[model samples]
Target: MIKSMDEFTLTINGKQIETKETIGVINPATEEIVGHAPVASKNDLDLAVKAARSAFPKWASRSFEERSELILQFANAISENQKELASLLTLEQGKPLSFAEREINMAVYWLKESANHRLSTEVLEESETTYIEKHYTPLGVVGAIVPWNFPVLLAMFKIPLALLSGNTLIVKPSPYTPLTTLKIGEIASTIFPDGVYNTLSGDDALGPMITGHPGIDKVSFTGSTATGKKIMESAAKNLKRVTLELGGNDAAIILPDVSIDEVIQPIFWGMFLNSGQVCINAKRIFVHHDIYDKFVDKLIEYAKTVRVGNGLEPASQLGPVQNLVQYKKVKNLIKEAKQNGLKFAFEGEAPRSGYFIPVTIVDNPPENARVVTEEAFGPIVPLLKYQSYEEVIERANRSQYGLGGSIWGKDIELAKSIADKLETGTVWINEIGALSPTIPFGGHKQSGYGIEGSVEGLKEYTNTKIIRINKR
Candidate 1:
C-alpha cells in the first residue's frame, strides 16, 4: 500500500484537499502504479489562487529578518524529513538512490543559504540633504511551474527564493511527477502561513490556470522551449512578470591537448548525468580532429561500464528515462540517427521492459541531423568532429538554445578564451553545467528569458520601487 502521501492527497491552505477525480502516480522503473494523487479541478485552482492573494499581505509585510526565519524554519523542516523526501524523490524521479540523496542535500543547502542571502539596496544618490533609495519589494503570488527531471531541487530553487523575497507561491508540478511535489506542499503547510505555499496537482489545465490567473504577479518556469513560449503568451494576458529556464542543446567541446583519462569522467557525467535528461547536459560533443577517433574509442569503452537499472538498487549507476513519452522520443531519435548513417561509439544494452535506455554515443552525425540538432534529453549523445578550434566555436554558438556549454583542455587559459566565445548563459572551462546558488543561472537566445539562482533570481520575485527625496 502506498501510504506516504495520505494516499496522494493535495495540500492547500494547510489542509489535505482533494477532488472527485484523481491521478495515478507511476514508478517508471517497474511501470507500476505507485499511488494516486488528487486531480485538482478548476474550482480548486481558483480557491488556491484566492488564498495566495489573501495571504500575500501578511507574508509580504513581514520584515526581511522575519521572512528569513520562516525560510530557515522551512529548511529545517525539510532537513528533518530528508530521508523521507529523498526516498519519495527516488521513487517518483527515477534518479538513483544516492543521487536523490545528494539532490536532497543540495536542496537543504540552497534553502539554508537563501535564507541568509540578503538583497542589497541600490543607492543611486545620497547626500546630507537628499537621498535616493532603490530596492525590491514583494510580488503578490508567484506561480512556479516545475519540470519532472529534478522536481525537488527546482521547486526548492523557486520556493525558498520566492518566499525569502516575501512572495507567496502557488506551485504546479509536472503531472508526470507530482507526488514528490505534493509532499513538498505538505511539508510547507506545516511551516508557512496558510495559503503561503500551495500545490495544485492536475493535468493540462493546471498550467494555464496558474499562468493566466490575474492573482499571479510573476511566473517562474523550467521546461521545454515550446511550452515556455506558450507560457509567455499566457502570462502576457495579465502582463505578469515571467522568468523562464527552458530547453537547452548544450555543447561541450574537447580540445586537442586534453588527456582522455582526465576529461572522460567529467565529460561522461556532463552528458549522461540524470540519463541526459538534464536541461544543461552536454547534448552535443564537438571534438578536435586530433583526438576525435581516440576520444570516441575511449568514451565508448567508458560508456559500457555505466550500470543502468531501478533507482532503488544501489548498484544502479543510471536510472530509467522517467516516463513513456520521453522514452519513445529517445527511441525514435535513436532509430532516426541509425538510419541517417550515424554510428555508435558505445553500444550498451537495456532490458526490454521499463523506460531504461543504455548510454548511446552517435559518432559524427551531420549538424543538421535530428539527433545532432534536437535535444534528445536522453542517454543518447552525438559526438561531432571539428577540424579547427575556431570552427567548433562557431558551431557551438550556432544554436537556438544556449543554456550552457563547456570547453575541455589542459590549458585552462586557452579553454577560458574558447569558452568566452560561446553564446550560452554559462560556460565551463573544464566542467559542464556546474551550478551554484551563489551565482545566477539563465540562458541566452531562445533558451528563454530571465535568471535563476543568486540574488538576481531573488529580485525576479519582486518589483523595484524607486524613491527620491530632497530637502525643501
Candidate 2:
C-alpha cells in the first residue's frame, strides 16, 4: 500500500524524475500538506514529448489484440494495489474512503470495457473492378488534462481509449489531486513501453504548455468551460486535436406522477453525490407545482439523514470540498443566498475547520441569483418550481452549459419524451446521471466538445484513412 505522505515525482520515459521545484499537495479534508509532488520543468516536458514521439511508431504498430491484453494487465495491477490507491485518493480528494474504493474499481472496469472496444475496417464500396477500405490510424502523442473531481475515474475514461487506439499519452493530473493520478503512470510503466504513458504534476503553467506544445498531437481535457476555451485558443496555435469535457449546470425535472419514496434516494444522491462535485451531478432541480411542496418536504426529510465529516470515518457520507478555493466559493454562495432572503427548506450549518461545508440546499431563489445560474460545483443545490413541462424544459436549457440532464416520472414514456428535448449531452429518463463505457458522452454547447467512452470516443484518438484498390 502506497502511503499518502510518500514523496512523488514526475514520470518520463518510465523513470521517476526528481525536480528542482515541487508543489505541496494537501489533504483537503484536513487542509494539511499530505506530501509534495515534483513539478515538471520546461526541459522535463521536452524530454517527455521527445520520448513519446520516439515510441509512437512502434507502439501504434501493435494489433488491437495485443493492446487489449496490455490494458487488461494494467487493470490487474490496479486491482492488486487498490487498497493503497483508495487511501491515497480519499486523502487527497476528500471523498469518502468507500467512494475512493468504488472509483478505483470503476476505473479498472472501464479499462477492461474500453479494451474490448475496437474498430473493424469498413468497406465503403466494393465492386468486381474496384474496392475501397476505410479504417482508423493513431494520432501520435495525446495530452490528457484531468480535473480534481473523480481524478482516477476520469483518467480511466481517457487513458484506455487513448492507448488502446494506438496513441501515446502524457496525463497531467490536477495539482490538487496528483497522488493517485501519478501512481497510475508508475503502475503502467511496469507493462507499457517507455513513454507510452507519462504523468506530470505541476502548477497552472503545466496545462498551457501541454496544450500549446507542437509535438503533442491531441489534448483531452476534463475541467471548467472557461479553461476549456483557453485550451482551445492555445491549441489553435498548433492546430492540435482537442476534446474537452467541461463544466455543467445540469437540471433534473420531477413530474407529478412519480412516487416520492421510490425516487427520493436516487434524486438525493444524484444531487449530492461526492458532495455535489460531479460534472454530471444534478445541480438544479425543477419540480412540478402539484408536487413541489410535498417533494421538497420529502427531500429535506431524507437529507437530514446525511452526515458530513472527514472521509476517513466509516460513516462519513459526505466529505469536505476538495480544496480551499471551492470551499470558499460554496461559503460565499451560502452567504449571498441568505442575504438575498432566500428561504431554506432544510436548515443546516457548516463545520468550522478544514474545507468542510454542510450539505446545503437552497430553496427556489430568484432566477438571477448566482446559485441558480452558475455551476455551484459543491454541496449547495437550488430547487426551482415549475408550472408546466414546456416552461421546465425551457428553464433547464437556459444555462450556458449543456453537459447532462435528467427527467423523472412514473410514466416512463412521458419522461423519456421530455428527456429527448433537453439540450445536454446525456439525458436520463426516470433516472439521474449514469455513465457506461459503451455510451458516447459529451456536452452540447459550452460544456465543451468531442466524445468519450464509446467507439466514437476511440475514433477521436485516430484519423480515418481510405485505401482504394483496382483490379488490373
Highest TM-score: give the candidate number: 2
> Alpha carbon lDDT of residue 44, candidate 1?
90
Candidate 2 lDDT by residue in tens digits, 1-472: 3333387878899887889999888998888988888888889899999999999999999999999999999999999999888999999998999999999999999999999998889999899899999989999999999999999999999999999999998999999999888887788888899989888989988999999999999999999999999999998997899999999999999999989988999999999999889999999999898998999989988988888888899989989899989888888998989998998777555557889888777788878899999999999999999998899989999999999999888888888888889999999887777899999999998997999998999999999999999975
On lDDT, the candidate that comes out on top is 2
lDDT tens digits by residue: candidate 1, 1-472: 1236446677778787868998777888989887777888878988888888899899888888998998888778778777877888888878999999888888888898878778767899888888898989988889899999999888878888899998888888899889878887887888889989999999878898888888788999999999999999998887999999999999998989998888898899999999999999999999999898899888877888889989999889999999999999999998887887787777687766789999888879888989888999999998999998789988998889989998888888888888889898999888777788889999999997998989888888888999999954
Clashing pairs in 1: none
Off by over 4 Å in 2: 1-5
Candidate 1, residue 49: Cα displacement in angstroms equals 1.1
Candidate 1: where is the Cα deviation over 4 Å? Answer: 1-3
- Residue 323, candidate 1: Cα error in Å is 1.0
Report lDDT per candidate.
0.87, 0.90
TM for every model, in the order presented, reads 0.97, 0.98
- At residue 298, give the lDDT of candidate 2: 92
lDDT of 1 at 19: 81
